[model samples]
Target: MEYSESECHYRIKIILIGDVAVGKTSLLYRLTYGYDETIRPTTGYEYFNKFYLFGDEIAQVHFWDTAGQDKFKSIVTNYYRKASGAVMVFDITNRASFESLKDWYKELKKFGEEAVEVIILGNKC
Candidate 1:
């Protein structure tokens, strides 16, 4: 079925995961607030929600902005459990950050959830 911009009510939960300073918060703000860099990096986690109207249905996009620190890994993983999608970000100049994507994906898969769609964004890209 072709989904029109104004058709259908969908509920989506997304989580942002990546290395520290990879601009997870920035991305969230960019999409939700119009620009990411305009806001400061998020601490711990932040929540955002938006609605999309599909015909007569309303689609709700729920976002979870997570901390990129190793210390916050456990907490971050917890938020990914039921996530419908994940945005994995990394700095274009940082290869290590890009390399860590696998680990983050692995952690999410470990929770027995394979329904999540992924969007990998290289900050500089």
Candidate 2:
């Protein structure tokens, strides 16, 4: 089969999940929106669009920022189930936050299985 040079395209959905004030929103903004330390946590879930060009095709990356609070646990957990990849964040300055990584890992595992790529981030470390 002869292929033309115009059919390549791909899209990726990534989610950022963690405890409150763990820098999940900060990291996403920093990387995606070019946000700095001044950026604040997303109250609930925020969406960001990222586009990349591959050869002559354009790939879109849809990023979902999930809340990092226990009160929103169920809602956040449900989001993780559909995540193709996840970024788990923790604040290095707080030992308690760092310690919560284990629980975050467990929860993420239950929702995002091995098929979902995980990136653990320790901010201020």
Candidate 3:
């Protein structure tokens, strides 16, 4: 589809949150740039931009990949502001990772846009 600048109306900002080693980066890579065997862990945060066709409208999607380490929680939380959506990821084999979903959800609601869309992702299944 050919999309002009004026045809872009929807702007979607998505954030990915999960504990360390939960494969959040891998998931983002697969979605935005296809699979890569050399994907590395995100340090603090990373941003990716892509455009998609939603019916007749062109949507610009901004994906933010946040670090899952405790030390980076504060930094990660900052990116939640004005987020249009979020993906809370967890490792299927790790119970603790799943348990942290509630905390992540709470943070997303507390800091992100009130009408933000959310989805849970179980990785390594």
lDDT of each: 0.81, 0.77, 0.90
- List the candidate 1 regions with Cα displacement exceeding 4 Å: 1-8, 36-38
Model 1 weakest lDDT span, ten residues long: 1-10
Q: Which candidate should be chosen as best, given lDDT against the real structure? A: 3
Q: What RMSD does model 2 have? A: 5.3
- List the candidates' TM-scores in order: 0.83, 0.80, 0.91
Which structure is stronger by TM-score: 2 or 3? 3
lDDT of 2 by residue, 92-111 (tens): 88888878878887888888
* lDDT tens digits by residue: candidate 3, 40-111: 889999998788987777898889999999999999999999898899999999999999999999998888
Model 3 worst lDDT window (10 residues)? 1-10
Name the better of 2 and 3 by lDDT: 3
lDDT of 1 by residue, 1-125 (tens): 33443553677888888888888887777776686445766668899877766666778788899998888777777788789888888899999999999998898788626878888989966
